[model samples]
Target: MPSTRRRPPRQRHPELERDFVRTPALGYEDVDGSGLVRCLAHGFPSPLVRWHFHDEYELHLITHTSGRAFVGDWIGPFEPGHLVLCGPRLPHNWISFDVPEAGAPERDLVILFNHDPIARAAEQIPEMREVLQLLDRARHGIEFFDMAEAARMHWEAVRGARGMRRFAAFCDLLCDLSECTDYRLLSAVQMQGVQAEAQVDQINEVVNRIMARVNEPLSLAGVAAELGMSESRFSRFFRRATGNSFTEFVSRVRINSACHLLMQTDCFIADICFQVGFSNLANFNRRFLEIKGMTPSEFRRQAESRFGAG
Candidate 1:
């Protein structure tokens, strides 16, 4: 087989560029009954806490505990007082270190709102203009290294206040964050754009189901049938909503999970292949090579070299 392990040059075909753009999985949050901005607190290990994205911009504050934060392809340490802004369609998740004694406590305070609402407000109010640039930069995910106190105050205010007071506080919070200088972009690669919001909840539900049973023998036709959709209709809908065909998306997710297993466990390659739902070793190796650029053994060696053998 030809070597598929190399990263292609920047100047490839236009079609290849689109193929390289991997859209993050959609996350659907019900905020219709709430105000323009939705403020909520979540505990660690909750169902809401997962590797997913949405159509709204997220202002996330790490209130308690310390652990790893995954944004796009970047993985790094995060602690209490950590603050970040993830633009629409940026896949992110924070996995906290388990403290058996303390248990899983409420760890994050988050505010989510749409891009257009803030942009339109900026057009009408010149003082809000500064936040426009900040929002643009958030496409790669922004981590604020300073302004912990300001973030904490605004997070609490937005959660507690109602009516116009909450709206004003929310705007002020954006103004404060927009002026901050101590921040860095997290993701190396730019993400594919957002999809239709109306379809997001349904797509998220289907994606969540796929994630839950990734290690089992999953079939596209079966899932389509379960949703009471024809196979062709479901395939087209999934591609339009997620920017990837069902098979390609599932393989990517499976390979990503396999990478974690390779780094964290001592399981044999064949065992991992089976664990990730591949029927045979050869098929698993082939798919893994296409998505991950390296064979299973090579990936393990490289991962262990950088992170140390677990």
Candidate 2:
């Protein structure tokens, strides 16, 4: 497989790049009407499909086609009924491999909204506070399973309504997403709720250390000793807070870092293996394939499509 030798463009404005004649009706005016939410729809093979980020929380649904999905540091497959919520500035893109020569007429349904309005309101509205955790999880990107049909209905309702009705529909969607349990957090590391502030601080420090010195050996026993805890206690504490065993979390961090290098640099895969702290070529390849579902070279070749056709 070929590798990308440079970085992809980081931002794109589809509305300005293409005429709306081919896309589904857009709800851009709703941003002005409701002063918060904006809905968008686009077809496959359109300029809208690119690696990019913006300052809005986006709920994206795929109504047709199956292909690869790139969200922050996560790479995976997505098919019809795929739904994901990406937080502000989290880079993402979807490339449909099943598109016909004529291209798909309507493949994506999206809703974009700002964070400040709802966050500020939650400060005063007790009921509105429930969605805050959901929003926080969006920072890492959230893929909701079994939510496609309901998500489609909600998107249509919000798209067709105006004024308070539009806001109400949007809120109703957020409520269901907040209560959703069939979802996975994609990108970086997964963090569960930590009850104590001190514990949060401790875990944060440990994560920062791991990220900073990823090339170094970090053992659970060593970390436990540093924290003045026994091996089993530290293991339980770390797992409870991060949803991964200490060793697994370290491996994930290394793999995530390797993904970035594969996308941005032309370094040899063997060199990258050791650069990310893996002891040997065979182990690195195994771990990367296990986590990303592709070999390092295969990922690089596929990732180049994220920039879209120039």
Candidate 3:
């Protein structure tokens, strides 16, 4: 007998293409009556995914396919069973690159929940502080390298349960993730002032400037003028807020951009240097070596060996 079940229609949401501004917050509804947590499993050919953020902590499992995973300012490879925990308002997306003859199957197992309820629970119960601490680490986003199957089982349990049973399963999943020691932080550094709107705006302004005009020379004085602050005040404020000085932050961002170019293009080393904001090849080489521990040519070689060129 042929199966007659029809798949649900795909849902679409706004996504950030290159702009790192605030991603749209997707509101989840309790259509089936599970209010505190929302679990969803879906498939797509080439899903309408994008770099986005929300106020909910997301435990995302890549159940199928492979591609690049973008979280915060990090971009790396991902495959099936890739499990990551994203803290509230952390920008993230997973883009699949597989092209199967049968089309890509269901790819994501996602669970989203708010931290306030958990925080309230933790305050009432002393032991739940560990979970709160886990949430803090999630601010940088966490990619679990071990216990993939266990996390999947917990996700399934939560997806299948209802009422208090669902909540209990969710709690168990968080406990398991919190206890797991084999994980890596995805972002090079976590974004600061997640809850402070003005601080986040300043960071975004700087980030947007760097990413958009990576080829142009960046100066603290110019940035300060653009933001209407004195250079000294801006320097102090940016360092305190983001844990990186203005110049250091710009160079880091430029280097990261150069890394992507190295892996994705066949451009000449010196041209790549000028294209990523360095004034001269020597300075570019020096900065790249200091930050990446390799010269531009060497970095390109490694990237080619790892990803097999664009």
Candidate 4:
């Protein structure tokens, strides 16, 4: 089993880089809505959060919102001043609510770039050899606090450059990241292998069902029935295919939906709970604390603190 971060979604052909090169996911383009973005740039409304992971290491320089960020098994609060570096293939998401505007764009700048270029550059430069090592760890992800400025400086360079210069600037940014000692890896990559003959595109139909009825009560049995599969078979099929069980997988996905609400609205937890499919307050609290490892209030407090300094 290869250990470096690379998982071709079922819709894509792993052997064909071009097939996965395009933003393969529906709605959430690898880039974004404009399509002109060489890198993805999205500014979500205060409440529009999505809990999703991808095949690339992502740098999220958050400004003007504070909330809990769930990366793998680690969860903590962050704010306008947060730097969330998500590892490739980890099931993670960030939750924020209407962050008070801080004279910057309301939507945070989410920059996505492929790891291959860094791999290419390191082969030619000894200065970046260590950086390559860091990236291998980054397959699990990393996070920095009070460090977006350092990253912002790098990002500004990348965002402003033109032609090959832009590409070079981005390379330099990776080197800069490699040099930082304060960074934390989310965890060593613990991803499962994709089945060689798995029918991923067909399964998206199931994923689509979850996405559409996320807020409503959804059961694995019902979903399987809708998909014309037997309950027991669907259970086994989902687990083998996704590296996740239907219940836990659905909960992970629901948490992601909750994150969007947390960042975009002033709605109370109870309301947000219902909005994300939990009907009881105790259950919501239990799940949030278990999944996020912080009480919602504590999570909020930490986020505010992080943003306060920013």
Candidate 5:
């Protein structure tokens, strides 16, 4: 039977499109390798998906953008001016694009540093050992305090300098971060569920493909075949990973996309239903209500009311 529920978020971009090169082994040599402190790049792009991870410590200073920020399996509605520190190999991505008319995309800086030296530095002191352990969990990702003018200043300082002076400034930035008390670590894999990150990534990849083919009928066997897994195994794995059956996941994604279109674009509701992968209106209306706690028309009315107020 066709789905009758709103779909949740799905992957975007689908590839790491870095403007600067900063690998762990080569460090920032790909960009400017004159100093020992290699690997620092900044970004401020419109919200899009392409979930991937790297072996580096990443500091993001989002100046004026907010949405459903997904760091690993940790998902939430983030406010503007968000700062996050993600450790190595922990799959993470932002779903801010899914929000209807998400705020500004203008950002200040994004800093990425190879993890080896930072790990080695924390290894020397027993007292700071926990902080190093924190870095390990960062492998799963960290969502730190918002705005944080000081953190933004630090990012600017590290990126604007060179030589040993730059390294010292980077250290200062970390010290300030370590002293911060109001921050939250992301990804359940960081604290528990050892395979959580991998599981989420697998589900996300599947979800991305689903998004790419939203208009067509999806079959369990077909999806499993695409991912090279047997139908039964895929079913179990997906359920355990997302706590939603495959049917529920797809429905949520389609309807959520429909809602985004309704609020952000001038598309008709009937058009949006199919555009987001649903086959018809009844299913879309039912699913939209399930996920959003309101009917589709009600959702549109409320959104219009809010928009008018703003």
Candidate 6:
């Protein structure tokens, strides 16, 4: 049986902190170097486990333990073989529950690479363009399922090889991720292109306000009037810019905040409901079920597994 001891508490970092900034380890000269691709392995209690974002894309794989994963506005469970691709500047973190007091020596295998080089190379290399779509989807944080063994094998190939061989192995891994269909987009909303810069600014202001004041009441009519547009027009503009209706986007934001509290604190569900701006408990439960496919209590119960045995 797995140990039921609770793991030590980790220091919570601010949501927007741009942590883990460093130059990529260029492996072109060394026989065992990773070149443009930076490969990293670390344990659960290590400094690498934090809520932060970076300028490069990250391919993350779980090799041990179960825990809650926070990716952008998405929150869910992760176990061995779980894999995700996070685009540049998209914040993410994984907290393992099953770690022992001494800690597991290895919990994650990661690959970090930048998009500029690839995008530039694709301008001349048509074959490399296949990964462009994969990178775009990664902007919303892509979670791939049922490919753990293959991912580990590919990571090993890249880790052991160097120079052209290493690059080839990395490309092979990207090709597989690109073709994979058994995956889900983690973020609740995606930002599509808008018509004008002013429109983008207006919408961004509204979005910033919504996120900043998630606990406050937000009505489309009020926001539309503030933006000097009719409710109908604002609805169209909001949906186009955010891929979700105004109300739906607000609900997702609140629910996302509630999820963070659920995983990180022992607050009662009813208390959390009000804390996140829901006026009633039933409405909060319904919305949580609708979005997370679980009741708040059940979500917390499952989240406890991240600490190991329940």
Which numbered prediction scores highest in lDDT against the true structure? 2
Give the TM-score of each candidate: 0.53, 0.86, 0.59, 0.48, 0.48, 0.66
Candidate 4 TM-score, true structure as reference: 0.48
- Expressed as tens digits, the lDDT of each residue in 1-310 for candidate 1 is 8887645322211011111122222122244444788776767656565566777788888878887676654566788889999888876778777434655567878888888877888789898788887887798789998777789899888877777898988888988888888888775422233457767777877888877998997889999999889999999888877678998888877776776677557777888888887888999999888775678898766543222112
**Candidate 5 local Cα displacement, residue 137, angstroms:** 3.1
lDDT for predicted candidate 3 compared with the true structure: 0.74
114-155: candidate 2 lDDT, tens digit per residue: 899999999999999999999999999999999999999999
lDDT of 4 by residue, 113-217 (tens): 567766776789776577666666666667864577777777667676666777677767776676777866553222243445446654667777877888888
lDDT of each: 0.73, 0.85, 0.74, 0.61, 0.61, 0.82
Least accurate 10 contiguous residues by lDDT in model 2:
13-22
lDDT tens string, model 3, 22-89?
A: 12332223445766887766654433355567888889988888876767655678898899999888
Indicate whether candidate 1 or candidate 3 has the larger TM-score.
Answer: 3
Worst 10 residues of 4 by lDDT: 10-19
lDDT of 6 by residue, 1-310 (tens): 9999766544333344342333233111232354688787777677656667788899999999987887875768889999999998887889888888899888989888889989999999999999998998899899999999999999899888888898999999999999999998997555666779998898889989888988989899998999889999999989988889999999998998888787777777888899889998999999999998889998777654443334
Candidate 6, residue 248: lDDT: 93
**On lDDT, who's better, 1 or 2?**
2
Clashes of 3: 0
* Model 4 ranges off by over 4 Å: 1-38, 46-48, 98-105, 188-310
Residue by residue across 1-310, what tens digits does model 5's lDDT show? 9998666533222235353534533223356453534444322343323355666666766655455554544445555567788776654554434333544334335676776665576678555454564565566566677437887788668767887888878778777777777776654321223276777678778777877887779888899998899999999887776567888877766765665565445566887788877876898888887776677666555443221121
lDDT of 1: 0.73
